[model samples]
Target: MENGSDIDLLVARRLQALRTRSGMTLNALAERTGLSAPYLSRLEKGERQPSVGTLLQLARVYGVSVGELVEGRPGGDYHLLRAADATAHQGRDGRYTVLSGPRAAVSVMRVELPPGSRSEEARHAGEEWLHVLSGRAGFVLDGEPVVLEEGDAVHFDSGRPHSLANEGDGTVTVLIVSTAAPTPASHPMPPASREATPVTAARRPAARDR
Candidate 1:
């Protein structure tokens, strides 16, 4: 894993690629995205971590999903990204790496949930498949909490409010593939609350090492 920097240069490259593929100059893209040219330029250069909300806006303008904006070549008979090329992104929610180019039907992501950290509560249209790759964590669906350990996996509808938490003392890494609807195509985003609120789970027992 490339963890030398917080900036995900892969996202930077992909953003520039998508914009170039559409034959749009930075100025044109700025006009289309309603984002200032300088800010967009920073995003393309990996100088700033693009927030989920910002990615949503760019996705709509590029006719793609937030996942697509962070992935590899996008579409083809097959998609492959060398391990060294994978970019790790640090976000308000947590650290994640896009595992594949967003498909017409699904988006795959590898997420890290730090101990005592909880992701923002979010609900969207469609379904989700989650597999715990390491450590133990809590997956909250609506108001119920389900504890999962390494190798545990679950698939469920994503329509109900849901969030993930690393209630244990160690971080949990999960592979999430979702076919859920992204922020609606036209919902206005509040700059103040870029990502919904992240709720901390009540203190709980830490998972013992395997």
Candidate 2:
């Protein structure tokens, strides 16, 4: 069986690999994980140990099971996502990392804002939901500013002019899910090609000795 130390090493390696595969900078991962850049850097370097809650949060942000995060493999149907596999995009005001789902019909993203980042008023076709996994944030939807805290969830029409901001002293981490099919103008794939692909489960590895 894998010892606790072995599991810790695997988790650390997986975290670094995922972030690198996603092309996420340390700053980007920090933004996505609601952790400071320095802290994230330390974690990646194995200089710091994360709390169980922190590990779980990172797993969710990467759309991976906690077991995958710790074991460097999946425990079931889910796949592990790393900060390295995300496509990072930035606007004039805010930054976001897009973690595309296996299917193109939906997209998951991690968004981060500086203490007061904001976006221009714009609208799109579709619906979006934001779940605040950590920190505090505020959203301006159609001119109304709604504050959100950790564990808070909000859903809104993408066609409405909306913007977000970090309302607290630190950064805000939000898991954004978009339920819009990729459009021809935005995505080149056909509808049939946008469907989710099944991920086969793999056997769990034997635990290593400590």
Candidate 3:
């Protein structure tokens, strides 16, 4: 996995690219983000790292989520995914395997939840569809409980508060697809209290190793 410095550099490059693509100069971006032009220059050169707040400001200025700006890639015509080579992102909650390719219009992942595992309630910007692959799972959407067993599926607007838990003894595995791009703001995002960082059972892992 790439280290923090590597990610910083990658984000720096992305920031530069976004600014250039929007035909904005360092001073212009500085004025919009309330940051200094020299600091942005250093950031663009990877000489300095930005805080989360800075990233949010830049994301807002760019009219994209912090995720879209940080993970932005050139659009392409085709892409593919091979299950055999898929990397599983594991965390204290569970693990997930991304099923969508870079160019896929929708995002997808195979989520695994061990017995008793539960996710914190969160909300985002798009709609999500989930199909149970095995075992049983519990979903609380907009404060209503919904249970699903093998061969069951549910689709709901993700902007509503929701949480999940493994309801069976065995592991629960499900396929999740999002109609919109994933964003850091999708969970515990803007206009919501920022006391804690957003986290979902099957979402992207933290930028650093635990």
Candidate 4:
């Protein structure tokens, strides 16, 4: 039978494994869980035990239950997610915070781009949608550039080259959701419109973004 120390070790190992599998560094996990990096480091090393609140917060950030955190077993289908629990990171020209889902499959992220920042053109295998929550953004799709304002939404094939830039004076925030697996290409690209149609509402906010 496992002793109390062994259980602690198992919990630590599971937490560390989850963080690594999620492609998060200690600093990244700290940013997501709102915990100090040093404290997380100690927790991972089994040198310290986290409070119940801290454990619950970490579990939420990892998309797992508190039982999973302690028992080293997969929890139920229910996932506890919160917007404040996302992992934030600084990219080349902007800052991004993951809102929900997993990077390994379908993922959703909240992105903030400062004025004058431009993202490089790139292509992925999946499909993606971007909704402007605040400010305005300049998006380039298939060599064409268009300005998107608050409430504007765009959906496209990720296989095509695309980029995003912030031309407005203030910061721009967008909710971007994508699937890692490739999807069949059906409709062609549509003209850029100032307003997002109501049909796009079918893609509701992820559990965490709210």
State which candidate has the highest TM-score.
1
Alpha-carbon deviation at 3 in model 1, angstroms: 8.8
Worst 10 residues of 2 by lDDT: 201-210
Residue-wise lDDT of candidate 1 within 1-210, one digit each (tens)? Answer: 455353477778889998898888888877655577998899889887664335545765566655678654456677787898777778546788777565545667788877888776655555677888898778887676777777777676655567788967888898887764444334432222224334333333453332
> Stretches of candidate 2 above 4 Å error?
1-80, 83-89, 184-210
Indicate the residue-level lDDT of 100 in model 3.
Answer: 60
How do the residues 145-207 of candidate 4 rate in per-residue lDDT, one tens digit apiece?
A: 666767878887654666888878999998887653312222222333434232222223442
Residue 74 displacement (Å), model 3: 7.3
lDDT of each: 0.67, 0.57, 0.63, 0.62
Error of 3 at 193 (Å): 17
Tens-place lDDT per residue, model 3, 1-210, is 865567667878988987887788887777655578998999889887554335445654565544445555334565455666565544334666556655433666677888898865645445668788898799877667767767777787665666778999999998877655434322323333233323223321231122
Model 1 Cα displacement at 164 (Å)? 0.4
Question: Which of candidates 1 and 4 is the stronger one according to TM-score?
Answer: 1
Q: Candidate 2 vs candidate 4: which has greater lDDT?
A: 4
lDDT of 2 by residue, 1-210 (tens): 555456446657778987786677887666655567887777777666654334434554565544445444323454456766543334234555555434434556676766866544434445667887777777776666777777777786654556677888887888877655434321221122122222121112331111
Model 4 misplaced stretches (Cα beyond 4 Å): 1-76, 182-210
- Compared with the true structure, the alpha-carbon lDDT of candidate 2 equals 0.57
Pairs of residues clashing in candidate 1? none
